[model samples]
Target: MAAKDTKNIKLAKQIYDALSTEFPDSSCSLETDCPQNLAIRGILSAQCTDKRVNITARQLFDRFPDMESIASQEPEVIAEIIKPCGLTASKTKSVMAFAKKMTDEWGGVIPNDVDALMEVPGIGKKIANLIVGEVYGTPAVVVDTHCKRVMKRTGITDSEDPAKVEKDIMKAFPEAQWISIGHLSVDLGRKYCTARAPKCGECPLSSFCKRRI
Candidate 1:
């Protein structure tokens, strides 16, 4: 490995240790009642908050009860229930597609594979990683807005692209940490390294964060 790359690895260890200590309880904010339900919540979580997703998902599940129930419903009915999540027309299609996949294709099982999960409309790379990592304990990096911002600020990656940020994270952290690192970055982003006004003095990574900006 190049000398520069080796130095970055050491930095990764320090940041990982500091974050692990500062946010030991870091976890996915999205509610996970069941694999299938969590998948549905993920579909609703685009551009939406976790609290909202949880509430909306509960309402959806209460009315439909099962994947087959959701699959059988008219698209308009599903849209009405999930309208609060925003992107109603598209989200409705994704939700119904996932439900139908669950009932007819996967035999009521949500797959651990990222590609399979992404086959459903509106389930992109980030959500796919979330579903596989959170549901199946698979090692995957989810590069959401918080994670993307935190990573760039901390010098984990110079690029702003989610795919590139994910690559940098995978290189910096080991497979064992693949899941928790994303959650930890999110915690840091929310509590300290916020976009507008970061709390650097209180941030655990302030000591070595390259941009402290």
Candidate 2:
């Protein structure tokens, strides 16, 4: 391996260890009882808080119950129910599209393949990776805003782009750590390495964080 890769690997281990110790019970914040429900929640989570998404999704599912029911509803109705999560028009189309796919194509089974999941309109790489990783236990990294901020600030990757950061993380950490690293990065970002006025001193990774030094 190259010298840069060696350094990143070592640093990544330290970060993983520290974050593991700091947030021992980190998990995906999206609340759902079923895989399809989780997939729908992922679609609704764009530019919205997970807590709001959860609430709106509950309202949505309480009425629809199944993709077949959702697929059958008018886009306007779905839009009305999901308006609280914002982006009503586009999110409505995407949610109905996903439901139709679930009922018409996938036969109620959410796919484990990321690319396949991304075929639905609003389901981008982030949501696709989340669906596969969370739903199927696949080793895919979810580089959300929190993950992006924390990874860059930690000197794990010199890039701010989520895609590049994801690749850097993939190369630095083992496959088993991929899913949890995203959660851990999120914990670090939310608790200490925030986008503005970060709490570096109190951060668990302060000892090794380049930004802290």
Candidate 3:
């Protein structure tokens, strides 16, 4: 193989190995019994902590267990239920609109296609990628804050834009490793490679990480 191809293979192996060792049971944080709920939860998670999203989603789901109920509800009511997650006004609109779209257009089902999912309000590229990957078992790079930051520090990507970072990661790693790599990067960011004061000494990729600061 060429030098670039060899490097990509090596990086893919290293990442998979490290992630398996670090977070063997890793998965998305948003709790949901169904894939549609998981997609809705992921949308509500924007600008909000996963804990708060889980709590609010539980309460909201109790009253509105399906797309029809959520679509029928007023945005203000939804906002009140999800106030703890912050960005309530926008999130409420997004959720309500998303629910309506799913009910009317999607036949009360979340579409497995990323493009179709993105057509809904509040479902951006990152969240759409995540939904497709987690719910539909499609391989994709779900670039979040953690993945963007860590990928930059590790010299895997230079852009902070989630879309650009996703492209960079896809180029660096193999298709099979894309989903788990995002999860692993988030774990590394939360545990050792933090933004403010990264614990580089404890990081498995410390030697390979370009950012020592």
Query: Highest TM-score, which number?
Result: 2
Query: What TM-score does each of the candidates earn?
Result: 0.97, 0.98, 0.93
Candidate 1 achieves a global lDDT of: 0.91
Displacement of the residue 191 alpha carbon in candidate 1, Å: 0.7
Residue 195 displacement in candidate 3 (angstroms): 1.0
**lDDT winner, 2 or 3:** 2
- Per-residue CA lDDT of model 1 for 1-213, tens digit only, reads 877577778888989999999998998888877899999898999999888989989999999999999999999999999999999999999999999999999999889899998999999999999999998999999998889998888888999999999998898888999999989988988899888999999999988999964
Q: Per-residue lDDT for 144 in model 2?
A: 92
Q: Whole-model Cα lDDT per candidate?
A: 0.91, 0.92, 0.83
Off by over 4 Å in 2: none
Candidate number that wins on lDDT, 1 or 3: 1
lDDT ranking, high to low: 2, 1, 3
In model 1, what is the error at residue 198, expressed in angstroms? Answer: 0.8
Candidate 1 residue pairs that clash: none
Q: What CA RMSD would candidate 2 show?
A: 0.8
Off by over 4 Å in 3: 1-9
lDDT of 1 at 9: 83
